[model samples]
Target: MSNGYGKKSNSPILASVLHGPRDLRLEIRSVSDPAPHELQIAIKRTGLCGSDVAYYKNFRNGDLQAVAPLSLGHESAGVVVAMGESVQGFHIGQRVALEVGVPCDDCRTCQRGRYNLCAKMRFRSSAKSVPHYQGCLQERINHPAKWCHKIPSHVSLDSAALLEPLSVAIHAVRRSFIEQGDTVVVYGAGTVGLLVAAMAKLSGATTVLISDVDSGRVEYALHNGFATKGYINTKTSPLTELSDKLMAAKETAVDVVDIACADQPDAEGADVTFDCTGKEICIQAGLYTTRPGGQLVMVGMGTPIQTLPVSAAHLREIDIIGIFRYANTYATGIKILSSGVLPCLDNMVTHRFQGLDAVPKAFEVAGRTVDHEGSLVLKVVIET
Candidate 1:
């Protein structure tokens, strides 16, 4: 069947699909035209995130189950190729970054300016809804024009793909309400963790400490100047021991601790804590670490329901705030990328796959390899 794009036959179109756990298939599909409010994008760069990894490794992410064939990738950027009839404010050939999740604007949550929580949200490559929304790991993608934020002239497509994760960090930082001189600690050194640290620093945190199980990631953070102090590899050490080590080195307790680690430990002393890892254990740690009257922001997407430290939270009067995806941060993310405040974009992109045929290999490498210094970016483009 014709995809409506009317492209010449024999052109290669690549896509990634999850047949089951650890089963990613690359195939060619017909490209379609944009709807009235949508824009057709020639996808250039797509970043592999933890969610994509989860879908590739297990065909599931947290409570969301992938019951059918699904495409992978959400952190993506490309150039606009076609605009639907009613689409305005965008033109063909414009570079853009897509906001992966599009919410139904009529919901009460949306009306409340919390559109990220809208019940009818359609997020790309998620099993939360049946007939999953296809992702951008394809040659051409038709997306809502309103959700495509134009990239600044100076921002490269590689860095533009980062806007997706950067928006998450931006939301977490905003939720934490970080103030100048506040000491901040991030629990993970992964992409999101590093971005969180950088965003926290930009938000006025005087000292930012990042911890991770991978020493290589810590080294990357230190080498890239993204972190001030790094913690020893946490994979082998106990949580209490790590905390003690942090205390011994700094000689003082941190005011805020953002748990970016996938796992959590009991945090004893912190003013504000963020559970960016989204695991039950990390959520518990956020509760344990937060001081009285402090806040705990949950930013990670783990199991929908897990045992939480409710009694401790109540006793400590710590407010546990949950963050859905992100809202109203695309423009700010673009600005941040354009301003050149954050660095090491090339360093973050650790591996690159040539085409859609390499997607399965990309997922395999990302799943099995423990490389903390590099990230795997799968490039999906029209074969030149």
Candidate 2:
């Protein structure tokens, strides 16, 4: 029997699959038609997030192991090529960014509006459950219509691909409840770190400071204006020393500290601390850095089990909050990208690649590069 589209071919489309650690192979597979209430998209652009890299490098993330062959990308944007029956509000050639996770709506967590924690969530490229959901690295994808968010005409597909991570930052900002005139510190100049700083600024932060071990990223942040005070280079220095240096340089104690790096530091005196890095040290550092009664939001994904600074959190009355993917931030993220209110996008996209052939190269560049200025791409587009 012919496939859903009646398109017959000797060789199917190509996709990158993870067989094991550092084992990414391009394989061909038959394409399937979109199910009812789904849309088939011709993926145009994809971004190499840290999680994708981790899966590529280690073939495992936290408790997610690549027990079976799996596609390796989730941050993607595409154009609708076909729509299934009952799929409305989208058309052919419509550009879109997909929300990769689909939850069983009947679950208690899902019913509680915590869909990210739903026990039956099938996230693309995730191995937490069997019969893993494939990702959007291929030429065509069939995705649930509800999970797809249309992109504005002014916003490029590259920027749309960023919507996923941007939503993460937005959710983190919401969790922090950053008020107007708050002083914010982001501890990592990576994409998420940079995005957090930018979002915090948009959320009415009077001052936003970002720090990274890479001086290049610091310089990039300064040039891009993502941080009000530029990037803080925290190389080989203790947390206290770094905090002192930042305060001396910026002339104020950071009110909100967002830890975006994988390695955390003990940054004391911040009213709010966010651990976006998902590393044990960074988690501990977030707790240590938060002021009494402040909040620490954990956004990054770490090991299923890890040590934490319970004593510091309990003693200081720091509220530690966990963040799953995102709730309803796609439209907000698009607005932020389209309004041009956030000037960080210009500087954020430091690098660009053309065509699907360059995807592997893009991953290589993103993986090996340490300098944010030279390597940080606020958005990377893989064009046809």
**Candidate that scores best on lDDT:** 1
After superposition, candidate 2 runs with Cα above 4 Å error: 1-11, 230-268, 344-347, 371-381
Off by over 4 Å in 1: 1-12, 233-268, 368-384
lDDT of 2 by residue, 219-276 (tens): 7776777777654444334444444544332322232234332123553455555666
Residue 50 local lDDT, model 2: 80
lDDT of 1 at 305: 74
True lDDT of residue 117, candidate 1: 87
- CA lDDT for candidate 1: 0.73
Backbone clash pairs for candidate 2 read 264-282, 267-289, 348-378, 349-378
Worst 10 residues of 2 by lDDT: 253-262
- Output the number of the TM-score-best candidate: 2
Residue 187 Cα positional deviation in candidate 2, in Å, after optimal superposition? 1.5
Tens digits of per-residue lDDT, candidate 1, 1-384, equal: 333445443345678777899787777877656677888888888888888889887888978889899988888889987777788898778999899898999978999988988889989988887879988888887898999999888887778888888898898888887778665666666778788888988888766667655677777877887777676433333445544543432322232233322123553455555565665555655566566777777777778877664777798788877777789999998888888888656467777777777787677666633535454222222111
